[model samples]
Target chain A: MATDSKQFDFGFRNGRLRVAWYALLAVLLLVGGYAMWLRLQGGMRSTNLTSITPWGAWVAFYIYFVGLSAGAFLVSTLANVFGIERLHRVDRDALFAAIVSMVVALLFVWTDLGRMDRMWHPFAWRQVTSALSWEVHAYVAYIFVLMTELYFSMRYDLARVAERGTGLRARLAGLLTLGRRQLTDESREADRTWLKRAGIVGIPLAIFMVHGGTGVLFAVSKARPYWNSGLFPVIFIISAVLSGTALVMLLYVLRTRLFDGERVDRDILDRLATLLAAFVVVDVALTAIEALIAIVSLHPHEVETWRLILFGEMSWSFWWFMVGMGWVFPLVLVSKREWRRTPWLMAVAGLSVVIGIIAVRFNIVVPPQIRPVMEGLPHGSYFPSAVEWATSVGMMAVGLLLYTIGAELLPLTPLDGGDH
Target chain B: MSSNDAMPGVPDTPDRAQLDAMVDAEQADPRAELEDVDFSTELGVAMAEDAKAVSRGEITSEEYWQRYDDLAAEEFGEVYHETPNPAVDHDTAQTIEDDVAESLSCTVGSMASIAESLEEPAGDSEGASEDGEDDDHRWGMVIDLQKCVGCDSCSVACKAENRTPPGVSYNVVMEEEHGEFPNVQRTNVPRPCMQCENPPCVQVCPVSATYKMDNGVVNVDYDRCIGCRYCMIACPYGARYFDFGENYDDEVEGAGEITSPEYGVDRGEREPKKSPVGNVRKCHFCHHRLNRGEEPACVETCVGDARNMGDLDDPDSEVAEMAASTRAMQLKEGEGTDPNVYYLE
Candidate 1:
């Protein structure tokens, strides 16, 4: 314990910061809990949502988190399955972020359901034709793949730490290894084999099935021509990669600097930032192409919706956040070799891309919806209510807290010399 | 109808001469007559009888009523007599008779109008309508825009009969006023559920909550709907609405207490956040009213009779005949929805 403490800085932010963080989280939980209760009691009436705009911020956040999860998982695959050894440090952290982001995404979905109790019906009484129903099955398959990959990858380490650890960490590690204290090279190799298999299955599932399926959930709505194009699902995949890259980069910095007091690997961050920069360019091009296609198609609904997205009430989300901060600002920072090499600069670029992705998600959901499905029909206007924002903050806080606690209790960092 | 016609415990009939005198007596600040209950009847009859004599100057009206005054006092010692012999307007009486006849004709008109029917359905007008549907209640609607004054009677009737909560409108009157001011042309497009042959709403529903019936109307299964609002987004005509669990309970007394038996399903007293509350709702072509061998509330209550609803299965029906007109059109015809609701331009 003494040697480990010496190796890793463990200040707990001088204790007061830790107490304040928890106290703030606890207060938010209570506030969000009350808000959720109000929603359950009042149904969607508590929301600013109307018959015109049935989906709102909750749905935007749902797709945002789904993108984040898929992106993170794919990054992890780059290290674990594709043998990108330069990006190996991001592997476990990315996987953990993927799992936590999915949990948060699903929580958003649960909150968004009109009949929360009947949410199970999408599974029990599903229609194969509905992309949403198909998404339900996809989510389950993806979650299983993620869990299996994560557990098998962690097993050898869990087994190693089980013999030397104490408290919940030791108990959790002992339980995870199924009472097997043996960490022979043979078992470690088997663990790697299962992880590789899980990652192989998960790669396709996350890309084409999980997040892409979610994109199809909107694309198949023939009524909304703005989302009906084939490019939508592909765009979802590209943007998801962007978010995932940003999340891993951001999480790595926060984890290493604040908790471990370790100087970030400048080489790794530069490489990850470069990847993020490339993803942002692709994402930007795809968005521009979609906009041009919408203009060229000249479908009234599609054009009108695009008009609203580009210059309507919520256009700031696209211009100020998505373009200004998310794309250009981050791109310039990461594109410059000097800035990319700086850890703080890389962190700023990564966080900007992540936040801009949220704006992308919001623009995707809100603008198209604000345009009426039928002409002469009243257009819907929406702004998130305090309850929605509070609930969102609470759920995010919970996800972060869950990840924090899990990090504390588990050996999230890879053991030296690899699992073998 | 006048308030007098609706008033409780009022005299059904009264003598004209006495009614006039009674009006004059009350108008002139005459002394309050003692209650003559039965004697009043006698005095009224007497006044009617000798009214000519008093008017002819053969006998003074004061002396004639003075003779009846003792009779009025003896009939009821101290009660005030305020009961006027109401003249009962001839027009009002005729109106009452017409009301009864009109309502009775509505009942007889619906069944026979379809059964024996007005026109012989050309038997081969369109095969798309004939899918072995039931002989009754294959509801369809046709709107004659020429006759439609843009009077939103259909919208009002729908609101009243459906008892729809606020923000869930089942019918709408879309107005298109175009051209320069002097030469402007105004058109009213009364929109209801298309009840399409290929409803996009049914196709997009995740739970199969909304479906097109064999009878050609798209109906919602409230119990099955998850209130996902996917159907609303899919609908090209924008006919659908989410319930949002809102209520007119605050606006209209007992509005939340009774839900329309839409699609003939008797969903009892409306409650906040119930099945139908969270479900996506739309016009079922007034399914509840259809099952009762009557037209929808909108069809029944439309003042212009601009919108007609009847069995499309019965080729002779008005709506079916109107639907076959050369001027007939539908909303979003290019979408291939094949909407049953038609409009005459």
Candidate 2:
């Protein structure tokens, strides 16, 4: 225990910081719990949504988390499948985040459902034509792939840790090892093989089935012309990769600085920054092209949708969160070699991208709905109600709580010196 | 000539015990016993059958006598006497006739049944399922824009009949005015569920909860609906609405006590977060009313009488004829939804 403590801290070794983090999470859960209770009692009435605006903040959050999960999993593939050596340090972290984010995404969707009890209906009764139904199955498959990858990636480290001591962490690690305590080279090689296989399967599952399918769910809606473009799904994929890479970069730097008591990996941060910038460039180009076409077409609904995003009441979300933070600021920060060298600067860029993608999701969901499909129908108006914001925060806290507990108990950090 | 001589083919073998037993049986059920009796002629058989009907109280004696008086005279000539039945209570028969008349004028109950029966042939013409199979129809509607007064009565009728919760209107009227202040033309377009042949809502339902019925109406199976509102997003016309469980308890007393029988399901009492309360609901062309041979409430209650519903499959039907006219057009036709509802300019 002394040696392990000397080497690295899992959560916050400073007991006060740990307590504060837990306390913050606990407070959020308490508020969120009350809000969720109200939501359950009041049903859809608690929401400001009308028939014209059937979806709201929860839907945006759902897509946001889906993009995050897909992005994180794709980042993990950088090490597990593509064998990027520097990325190996955060591959397991990214994989775990992917699992947690996916669960959070699904939780958002479940709460958004009118019949939360009937959430299983999508799986039990398969509607071949529904993109959502296909997504339901894909999410299950993706989660399975993620868990399998995470298990194989950690088994060796868990076995090593389990053999060390009689403490609770050791006992937990021993149980997680599933009695496969054989620490032979063959077992390590076999674990790598399983991880690679899972990652291979998961790449397409994450890209085409999970996030791309969510894009298709919108694109297929001929009612909303803004989302009907062929490029929508492609943009979704690119943005997902961008967000995932950014989240992982942020996680790596934060973990190194706060918990691991180690110097941040500059090489990995540089590569991730470059990859994230590339994604951002692609995302910006595609979005610009999409907007240009909509503006040129002069189709009323299309124009109206864009107008809503750019100039409507909620336009601040687009200009500030999406364009400023999501695209411009992050792109500028990551563009410079000197800034990329600064680990905290890279973290800020990553944070900006993460926050910006959330606005991107909101723009995707809310704008098109603001313009009524047919004119003279009451124009839809919406803002996330109190319950909505509270529940969203609570769900995010849940994800953080899960990740915190997992990080403390599991061998998520690489068991090596800072060189790797 | 005696009655027996006139009917020479008849056999007469009267046993006192059998005759008494037969008479007793006739008292029990005149129609059943009379079936065994042999008559001399068709007229005799017809008169005797009616006489038995009168005796069993199936028909009033006056109705029976009025029916056979001329026929009896033709058969029996001078022997036919216009004698009223002593067994029938004339007072009771008069009271029954009076009650029927009073009930028809005083209450909707009997009138509704009468209306139902009167509508039977119309229902058949409108392609009500003859074999109790739904596939025979493609129900349709045609609205004349010129006739619409823009009163929103159709919307009101729809709300009243469906008892849809707030934020869940199955019908709406889109009104617009064109041209300058001096010469303006106002247009009111009443919208209901288009019941599209290729409904985007049905195509995107994750649970197959909302589906296009063979009868040309799109149905939302509330039991199966998870209420994701995907169909609401998918629909081009914005025809679908989610029932958020809001009721008119404040304005109308006992509003929640009785719910509209939509899709022929009696979803009694608008309970909070029940099947329909949590489900996406829309106009099913008043399927419950359609099942009972009645028009959709919007069509029935349209003050201007602008709406007409009929079998689109039937070329001779009013809606089909109107739909075929040059003035007939569908909203958002470029979307290729192939809406069942048509508007005549």
Candidate 3:
């Protein structure tokens, strides 16, 4: 563990590195807190929003994290429901990350509201006509399903860990197991059934209601022609799968090689990279078809939106971040079978997709809104203000901090008779 | 004017208190200084009581106008003809007379058919039942583009009446110029909330806070609104504006003392993050004024008199007649919004 990249180690094994990571996240949280304070005190005036461009970076980030969470949850289902044993090593960790990502996503959306205090209004009232209302309820339901699935998967391990010791880990495990100390073969079987059931329920919820519904939210707005296509939701689900696969891959590689100093699991890494590459190919095809339809339709609004994405003021984001890093670089790195087998190189590709998908979300949200809905209204122009950036960074730090803490406390690794 | 900062807990600047006192004095009720005054005529006495009832919402303005239509005409003579009232029920005889008048005025059969269509129940009207209210009145507006001089007075009038904050304009005049230098022509398009029969803002509102009223105006319940700004994006007219909590504290004296009487709710004092301050706002056809039997400020103040307001459900209403004219058109007609606002292009 004492290597040159010790500075980058995110594993909990190194005491000094753990403290450093905590200190870094604490600092970031403080900075984000200050930005959040400014946002609350100044209200929407703190941002560069106008009636012309009411939405901005926070909305993009909201959808981005929602995609990440959905993707991560779907990845977890691959093992828990589909019975893919080799994938179990990362399934529990992916579930934990999914929960944290959802919290972060909700926070980003909360900050975007003009009346942040009214965040609960969507839940309190129901409007069947609105896609966003359905999304709010779906997010809550999805989070509960994820927590239930995680609890069931970890129940047997937690009971065993609790019975074997009397230290802090034992006490934490005993508390988490909710007094269910009977670790019989029957209980284990029951836990497995419950876990499978939760996973099955979550698959459709994650695909159709959570992320796909997020896509439907945009698709239903016929006013924005760019997002009104039937392909929009399909593209969203595919990209969600892509980003989720990449995030889990990056997390696994970083934790094993840098943090734990354990021998990396080559088979799992190879499978993950292959899955990530396949998702990338599908995502690219869907995007091309979407772009082709928009261009061929020659509808002024649709044409204008694509034009803005391809060559507008923020075109560099599309070219460099979305297309170049998100699609081209990752595809190239994973294209060769030999490179896909390299854990570190595959991690790099995964990292590229994770970063690139952020740009993808931004491009989806912002470009379509830039063109005025009517003929002669002012064209929307937007760049996230300083407060927006600071708060977003802070929210990301919050998610990472929760993840780091979860990794330390939970028995997330594969069950191997207790001793690490 | 004394400098007085009436807003409590602020470090008082002497001049602020004086400014507040001056504002209060200026806003003092003129009725407080008057004694009981008797009307000289029976028609005047009856009309005064009915006006109060109209303002109080017990009776619609059309009801009051209908009661005194003959008397008003007799009292004012030729001068009364200058400003025609649309609420007067035009019977079949009057329709026949209007047919003759229409033949003399211009050649268009569409108006006759439109008037005929209004005789049937509105249940068959497309998109009318989508809002699920089949009320008697559906307020509407019509603007004559030829009469519009691109003065931007409508925009100013709207702001003055609505007391909108910076970057929030309920009405905006979008201008565009066509052709090269010698043959150049400028067209000013004054845009306001279409108050569509099927408003997308209403459809997309997650909280059901923004909705279509029975009177045909789209309204936002400030207290119920969550301020997510989804409606702003959904509105094809770009009529919706999010109040970013910006204030006119620097420019206007006592600007925050009284909120606009929007929907007749006098939301007192402009405070950051308050209901309407954080809500999505748009033109409601000057609904407060409409309740008071007055036209929207833009219609009243237009120098060219380009705008007309009336009950579109009434076949005899001026707005309905204009809406049936050959030049009448609705923006984004293909969008299937069925807007209550029309323009003579």
Q: Against the true structure, whose TM-score is highest?
A: 2
Docking class of 2: medium
Q: Which 10 successive residues of model 3 chain B have the least lDDT summed?
A: B123-132
Each model's DockQ score: 0.44, 0.60, 0.55
Scanning candidate 2 chain A in windows of ten residues, the lowest lDDT window is A1-10
DockQ-based CAPRI category assigned to the predicted complex of candidate 3: medium
Task: Sort every candidate by TM-score, greatest first.
Answer: 2, 3, 1
**Tens digit per residue, CA lDDT, model 1, A1-420:** 133533322224346766886798789888888888888887888888877787889999999999999999999998889987767677877888899999999899989888887887777677667887778788888888888888887777787667766666777889987765677888878877888999999999999989998898888877778888899999999999999999899888877776555678887888898899889999999999999999999988788888887788788888999898789999889878878888877878889988999998988887777877666678799999888988888888888787777666665666552322
TM-score for candidate 1, residues paired by index: 0.81
Cα lDDT tens digits for candidate 1, B251-343: 787777767777656679887767788888999877755554567888888778788887777887778888888989988788888898999
User: Per-residue lDDT of B127-161 in model 3, one digit per residue for the tens?
Assistant: 44323255467999999999999999999999998
Q: What lDDT does each candidate get? A: 0.79, 0.87, 0.85
* Global Cα lDDT for candidate 2: 0.87
In model 1, where do residues sit more than 4 Å from their true spots?
A: A1-17, A179-181, A417-420, B1-138, B313-317
Pick by DockQ: 2 or 3, better one = 2
lDDT of 1 at A193: 88
